[model samples]
Each structure stands twice: as structure tokens, then as C-alpha cells.
Target: DASGVEAVALALVINSGVTLVKTIPLRRFEDAVRFGIGLSPVFTVFQVDDQITSSPHIAGPTGDTRLMPDPSQTVGLVASPGWALAPVDQLDQDGEPYPGCPRTFARRMLERLAGHGLELRGCYEIEFFLGHRAAPGPDEADPTPAHTGPAYGAIALADVEPFATALIRAFEEQGTGVMQFHPEYSTGQLELSVPHSVGIAAADTDLVVRHTIRAVARNHGYAVSFAPVVFAERVGNGNHLHLSLWNRNGRNLFQGGRGPEGMTREAEAFTAGVLAALPALTAITAPSVPSYQRLQPHRWSGPWACWGRENREAALRFVTGMVGSRPDAANLEVKSMDPAANPYLALGAIVAAGIDGLERELSLPDPVQDDPASIPARKRRSLGIRQLPASLTEAIAELEKSPMLREAMGDVLFDSFLATRRAERDVFEGQDPEDVVRAHRWRY
Candidate 1:
């Protein structure tokens, strides 16, 4: 029992579950987990070419056309401990947390949670698509759809056997801790489920998984996209996050029994806080333009901010089993997030909001009884359930106005993210949904 507590606490530092091998030595694990040195802001340099002439009498003549160099200084990489590459030096010899890394954002959020004497536990259910990068033709049927034995579908798995085997092996090597890989409802859709971990470690595992999946798939000449709306008019990918909260003493604070939704006072407060901050959180969860394409009604996407027991239609789903059990299973699945969204920043925003609710004693709202989309628009509106941000523009606006989100991400990261997101949104402003997906599908 105490092992579980130690595991949970240690897991806050590393991404995957700790496993020991018969052949592996204990000393090897000393450097097995790569916990970086520290978090400090980095600097950036810009090269410029334009030159101006100065008066000889006032100041020394700056050679306008001679060998003069012009340089500009800009804010360097935003530092977060969980980042994979160092933030400032994109080309540094040693690996550092990559810029725009979501894991770093989540680490920052965990730091914030520490300030309030709290801890977090999280897990991710990620969905994606697997396809041949260089097929015979765009119109030709993929010959390698199921090139191996059919684990699920006799015909499909056999066609794509090689791809499946290679991907699984690669994932294992990368320490992704992949629980299962299965064919989804769509033709090429695949889902990867991973074991849960506590605090920033869980979020970091997510980052490693996402990057490894895409990179390994590419090495096999296959392209993958976690875009929620990857296939036009077909089932899209979703990055549903399972979240829970704990006190500093290692007690799960979310387990409750008497509430209308089977949530405790603290749980209710956390949920209420998430609901209160969701309008802004969407910008991080569904950052891309195509994200809104899946957030529409009647698509099993969680457009409405309604929570209920086993209700997939609601944005927040209350997952329960029976009586007062483990709070680990008594968490909420935020279904609004997509694969393209940065997991770190998105999770951080949500955790910050939930912690805010606990601090302020916010009251939870009534859970929806029926399908929110079918409850009639006016009725749904009356219940205080509104559709999430329909586009990146609206989502950004909501984020800009949320003081909680701004404070959680800090000024450097918040500003850099907004700037980068604005640029991304602008480039895809008029592109078709499918075009947008095609251009950015596997880049993440």
C-alpha cells in the first residue's frame, strides 16, 4: 500500500512506470531517466542586414556598404523542466526541451500546483491514423493496409501486419509504455492506450509518446495524424485526458459519495473551477483551425460543457464504478482536447483552473440527464451549458481574457504561445478543412 504512495510520488518526476529487468543492473537506472539540470530563461539572436548612414561630424562614420554586421536580440526559449530539449538553443549539441513543447507547459502547471500544496495525477487516451506515405498512387488501394495477421479484423490486420509490428517494437524501445494498440472504427484510425502516472510525469510521458509515435511511423514510410478531424466526414482522433487531484500528504481528494454527481465537495469545487475556466482552456486543447470541425454537435465530440455519468456527449464525463472507491478512477475525462493541442499547456490550464475552484470554494452545477445536443438548444442554454470555442480566433480571445490561464502559463510562455498560435491561425485562415489537415496532419 505504501509502495503505491511512493510510486505515485516518484512518478511525479519521470514519465513512465519504473520497470526492472533481470539482466539490467540497478546502477544503470541512475541515468535511465533523464531529469534535466534546472529551469532558467534562455536568450535568442536575430540576424539583420539593413544599414543606416550617420553624419561624420556627430558620430563615427558607420560603414554603410562595408563589412558591418547587424544583429537583433529577442527573448530566448521559455524554460520548463519537462521539456525534451533546451528551450534557448534549438541547435545545441546536447538535447534540450524543444520550443513549444507541451510537456514543459504541464511541468510549469505542476510547479504552480506545488505553490498551492497540491499534486496531480493524469493519464491520456490518444487516437491517430496509420497510412502509407508513398503508395502506388493517390487513387490506388493501399496494398499494405493489413500486411500481417489479423488481431482484430482477419482481413485488415493481415494487410497491415508489417506496419503494426514495426510500430509496436519502436514504441516499446522509446519507453512509451503503450498498453494496447487497436484498430478503431475508421479505415486507418488506430488508438494507443497508456498506463497512468502522477503529476508532471504523466504529462511528460504523453509528450514522449506523441513524438515517438509520429517519428517512428515516419521512419517506416507511414504518415500519422492525431488531428481530431483527420478524415473528412469520418471519425476523427481525440486526446481525452483523465485528471485527478491529491493533497500533499498523498490523499486523493476527489472521492465522494453523497453529491448529486457522486463527487465530493472538493471534487465538486475542482469540476466547477474547470467549468469556469473552460472557455479559455479550449484555446490550448483545440488550438488548430480544424479542431472546431470536430467540436460540432452530433459528432460524439464534447461541444457542450455538460457533465454526467457515462455521458460521452458531455464535455466533462464523470467516470465511476461503485460506492466510495479509489479516487484514481473517480476522475473526469476532458474529451474536448484533440491530439494536435499541446498536452502540457492544455493540462496546466485545466489543473490551474481546478485548483482555483478549490481555493475559492466554487459550487458544482447540476449534471445533464439527457444528451446535451438533443436537449433542445434553448433548454441547454438555460442549464448554463454552452458550446466550446468554435474557432481558433474565438479560442484565443477567451484565453487572452482569462486571468487564471495567463497566470498559470506565465507572461513569457503565454505571450510566445499566443504569437506563434496567431501566426499559425493566420496562415490557415482561408484553407479548406481537409487542406488544413493535409498540410499539418503529421507535422506534430
Candidate 2:
């Protein structure tokens, strides 16, 4: 019951593209519960240099702090000693919605969807790498990979059994369901599939899952990296989102008996909207410079803006259900995402884009039955398939010019997000590749 616990950690995802945590003594939990914790609004615009600034004039040293906790999200930390996670709501002093808040954006999107008689159900398929930190000393060697894999070989699972077993147990204790875990193709890489939940809960569960994995890895004397590409030469980690839409009547709106590939009209429009918006969506879903390193063609990171049935190489992969689940199990897997992205923003942008498609009644294009990159360049263009933004700078440019995304995220959020991303890109653009990886490898 953690009866002896002396503190609770309140975590918030800030505009800096990272989670900022504040620990309050247990005795003060009541005070927080009563009046809420004071937090500087400047945190929303903080850059890696601790500067509170953003483009289009968002620099602030005058706003008051507001941190309201969601009591329902409070959960015990089974992996970290004497710790607990309390997700907080960020707002302004006047109790108005903070345009910089990702969760606020997500809630607004959900509300918009509800207005259309639809709901979102989804989960994150997380992949990460475990490495061993060398002994602390001036002469310490570089961190060593935990396992060398033969690409999902049985031996790979046995190699990390102790850590994997503990991680699964901790996830269960923390109320985060684990559907499956396996070794990925890359060295030291492992993938975990979590059970899906609806809307905001799904994002909440993703935060818990990532936190649990990092905590459990630390407990085992290892370091875990959710960076998109841990090594330049190997397959990178991805945080793929599997999403489905449901109607108010409890029916899977994505299922259609007459639609192509068994996708309902609603699902088709939703997917078409997502595909159309993929170029700009890259700024949010694959938000880091290192993310672009992992999004290249032939790498299976959804390098092309196309959809295919069970195609890993396409940005959107439509998965068909098994016997027990049947049509209800069908969902769209967005493969161009990674863990560096804030789940709230990523999922929110996706829903908003899909809704835009639905509102406009957009039509789905023909599914790419083969590898998108394999097709000739001229032919690819004929099929309306285009390469995703290949760099963070390029992606941010698309995002900045995207009226749909700007409308979905609001001007304040959209501008601030771009400023933050631009700041990151400016820092990494001319830097050495190793230096860049070192800077972000452990942060995400």
C-alpha cells in the first residue's frame, strides 16, 4: 500500500518535448490536494538552455503557475522505490486552458470527436534498447549493449529473461497490461505491446508503460534508451500507435462489409485524412532530429505516406483481426511515430486530422500492396505516394505551413511547438552525429 511512502511525484509533459517532474513530500500531498501546486508558466516555453522563449512572440516571465492533479491517474510505482506517479493538469492562474498544454489539446480533440458521435481507442507498441553503463570513472568505457540479437531469436529472449520477467511483473502490479514482449531485430532492442484503452486513458497508460520500463531497467542496473535510433547502423526503436474508432452505439466504426480492405467509410476517411496530413504530422509524431534518422526508406519506419494491409513499410498499416476478435479487431497502425513524441500531442494531432478527413468526406487511395520504396520514383508519384519529410527542419517547415494542424492545435500551441522544434533543430543541425545522439539518447 506504500503506507510508509514519504513523497509523490507529479509529472507534466512540457513544451520542451520532455516530462518535467516535481516531488512533494507525502505530508504536503494534502496541501496540494486542497490548493494545487504552483508551477511557473514559463516551463511551457523552456528550451534546453533554460531560456523561456518561443517564436511568434511567446516569451513569458509574467504568467502565474497552475498545477492541478488528476486524482484518477495517481498510481503506485511498483518499479521505483517509494515513488508514485501523479499526472497533473497544467493551466494558467486564471484557471483558463493553457494553449501550451498537450493534454488540454488532447481533451479538446476528444470533445470534438464526441460531437461527431465517435471515440478513439488505441495503444502504443513500444520498442527500446537496454545498455550497460560502464563503471563510473574517468577511464570508463562506452555503454555496452545488453544483448546481441539474431533478429527476434529465442536466444535473445533468454538473454534478457531476468530483466524482462521483472518488467512484466512490475507492469502488472502498476495496472499496465502487457499483451506480449519479444526481442526486436536490432541489437539490445525489445518490444512490448500493451493493451489498448480509450482516448486520454490510452495516453496515460503510455506514460506509465514508458516510466515503468525505464524504472525497471534502472533497478536491474541497466540503462534504457527510447531514442529513435540508438545506433546509426542498426534498426531503430519505434513507438507505433495502433488505433481504432468506435461509435456511440458501441460499434467499431472502422469495420465495413462493403468497403475496400474491410474498412468502413468512416475508417476510410479517417485514414485518408491521416495520410494526407502525414507530411506535417511528422513534426509532432516523429518530433526529434534523431527521429528523422530512423524514418528513412527501406528501414520499415514508414518512410512513405501510404497505407497497405499488413504492410510494415507503409506509414499506415491496416491490421485484420483474428478469429475471436474478427472485424472488431481491425485498427490502423501509424508506424511513423517514436517514443520521443509526447503521446498527448501525437494522438491528438492524429484524431484531429482524422476528424478533418471525416468532415471533408475524404476518400482513401488504393492500398500499396508492395514496398513503397521499391516502386520507381515516377510510378510512386503516379500513385500519389510521397516520401515523408527527411529532416526535422523540413518537417517543422511543413508543420508551420499546415493550416489544418495549426487549426487543430490552436495558434498558440502550434507556434510554441514549432519554436521548440526549431530550437532543437538549430542545436543539432551542424553538430556531429555522435554528439547529437549522445545529447538525446538518454533524455527521451
Candidate 3:
């Protein structure tokens, strides 16, 4: 649904661009015509590579080639003679401002953070499912093993050795650091952690890693999904975003051994901002109907708006490694996000919200030592702890009310996204659960 919304938004922008920009030179058409008559329509997609390539047919029977950007060029061919001449790297479809372009939008938020003389860095740990590419029957059980080994077992290599080996190679080639891959609790589910990097590279590595996993898996006749739920009974997958902030002089902002919760004032404020914005950010972080199923309490998915040390049950987890561990290992792990989220949007929103907190000097609540899920209703209310969006419709409603997000993502793209998502919700909200799973479970 998010993908379709993106597509529709891009199409609208491209159409606007094509209308405003002058037509291609007549000579270019002549050149394309020379390729052959009855050939699929042809158009020159001026690419960053400084080359022009023509396709006889823009897309074959399958829409794969049509949606794929040219290998040598960054432009995607969406329709015959219609190409995405401008790379939507961080821009919108219309060559105008697009707040929805996660890359561009994240950079904007990062710049805002910089205005306060602070810097941010991030790392993403992705959990996913891998198994036979074939679809399973309704009553059929998935034959794939729960994992290659016990939880975090290095010895369970046999189950995912082939897949892991290829994943490692692809990550290396893509210039991404592969920290590790281990069997997770879910059947055939695996988690891969990447060495964290500063600023944009951290997000870039994540996007590349997702591409690498899918490509490597496809080559091996396996399908990999980053979906939150691949099966009802199994643990769902999640995309946990780990982040830390620092000052212009490179001081770790989240650390102040003598300060509140060992967090510096600035770090505390930033964390407060993110916590306050958590509900609204869910539209971009989780953003799917099925994602809510994974955010249930007691499932270890952070649903409550609170933070704690080494607490997996809290939305904002303050990870403290061993006594001898590097202090930088102390960072916030947001466990509410899922693979369905566009990394750019999620990162941007997190950064923006955190910046908001710092600018406003927001105060954070005391850490929840016991189970946040089991906290008394009165205590939870007193502390202002709230739950994340429980469904796509609710998530979108939250998103629609976010003035911060609307400002970060341009008015046009945001408006388009809202419209498209509302249309989709109208179509899919009340459908059969099994059919809903079948229709969208693997799409992301």
C-alpha cells in the first residue's frame, strides 16, 4: 500500500514535470525510430551516467523491467516512452521539494539537528524470514527450520550457511559491514546486524543490505521477506533502529555517568522529543496493517512510550553492554519499527522528532524498571505513557495530524500520500484476515 502510494505520487509528479518541461528534440525521436518500427515505443532517458539508452518495449509482460531503473542509469522506466529522468534519490517525482523522499527528508532533519550544534549517527539491525520461494497452502506448515541453530548460536550454520555465506559476500561487495547473522526465535527467521556508521551512511548501508539479501536469496531459489508477520503463531520480524547523538566536538550526547539515567541533558531532551512523537512517527516506522500485529504487549515489541536500560519491552531501550564494554555501545534501540517502513522516512522522522525535543528542552519520564506492559493503569496514565498505532488506519490518522512530518515531507507529496493511503484503506481494511495476509505479507 505504501509502495502504491509512492508510485501514484511519483506518477503525478512526473506527469507535472513532463507537462512543464519541453518535449525531447525531434532528432532524438528520429534516432529511436531508426531502431525499428513496430518496436515498443522508445524514449531517451538522460541519465547521471551521461548516457542515453532506448528500450523498444518499456515493460515486458511482467512489470519487473518497467519498474526497474536502468542498470547503467538511475532513472526508472515506468511507462513506454516515459522515464524517471531525475533520480528520486532525495527528491520528489516532480523535481520540486518532496518531503516523502526519505533520503532527502532525513538530510533536512539532520541539518536541523546540526543547527543546534549536535550530530547524529545510526545503525540498523534487520530481522527477516527466509524459506522456499514457493507459496504455501492455507493448512500447510512451512518446512523451513526455525533457525540454523539455537538463538544466537554460531553453530547452527548448516541451516542458513548457504544463505548466510551469500549474504556476507553481497554485504562486503556493497561496502556494508556485516556484524553477524543468527537464527531468531521464529521458524526460518534470521537477524542480521550491521556495524553502525555515522549519519547518512548508516541509512545507506541499511537500504543496500535489504537489496543484497533479496538478490542473494533469489539467486539461491529462496525468498526473503522483512515483513513483520510471515506466520500467525511465530515471532514476527522487526527493523530495530539504533541511534546516538553527539555534540559538534564529538562528545557522546547520550552519556553522562553522573546525569539522569546516565544521559546528558541534551541527550535526555532529544530522547524526550522522540518519545513524545512516537505515536505519530509510527506511520512511517511501522506503516502497515500487519505491522500492528507484531507490536502487541508481552511480545517484547516496544508498544509503550517509555525508556529503560537494557529493556527490550520498552519502545526506547537504553542498551548497556558489559562493564568493560565501550561506552559508545550505549545507545537507544527503537524496537517498534518493522521492515515495511521506508528506512529514509523512519530515520527522518526519528531525527526530526528528537530535534524537536532538544529545541524545546522537553523533560523525559523516569525509567520503567519493571514490566511496562504490566504497569498499573494509573501509573501508566500519570507518566503519560501511550501505545503506538494499532492499525494502518490509525497510523495514517496519526501521520495526518503530524505537523512536523507534514513540514518535513513537502505539502504536495504528503497530501498525495494521505489521499492514496485513504483510498487503499477503503479497499483493504475489512477484508478476510487470510486474504489480507496473502495479498500483502510478502510484498515489502
- lDDT of each prediction vs. the true structure? 0.60, 0.83, 0.63
lDDT of 2 by residue, 1-444 (tens): 546566788887766558888889877776776567887666766764455566564665666667766667777788886777787777777777777788889889989988988889999999999989666554545578888987898889888899999999998877877899999988899999988888887787777888899998988889988888887656888999999999888888667646768777888888899999999999998888888889988888998899999898999998977856855688899999988888889989999999999999999889998998789999999999999999999998898888999999988888888888888888887777766666677677
TM match of model 2 to true structure: 0.95
Superior by TM-score: candidate 1 or candidate 3: 3
Q: What tens digits encode model 1's per-residue C-alpha lDDT throughout 186-262? A: 66767787777777656656655665566566656776766677655656678889877777777666665566566
Q: Relative to the unseen true structure, what is the C-alpha lDDT of residue 295 in candidate 2, on a scale of 0 to 100?
A: 91
TM-score of each: 0.71, 0.95, 0.76
Higher-TM-score candidate of 2 and 3:
2
lDDT at 24, model 3: 31
TM-score of 1: 0.71
Arrange candidates by TM-score, highest first: which order? 2, 3, 1
Give the lDDT of residue 35 in candidate 1: 28
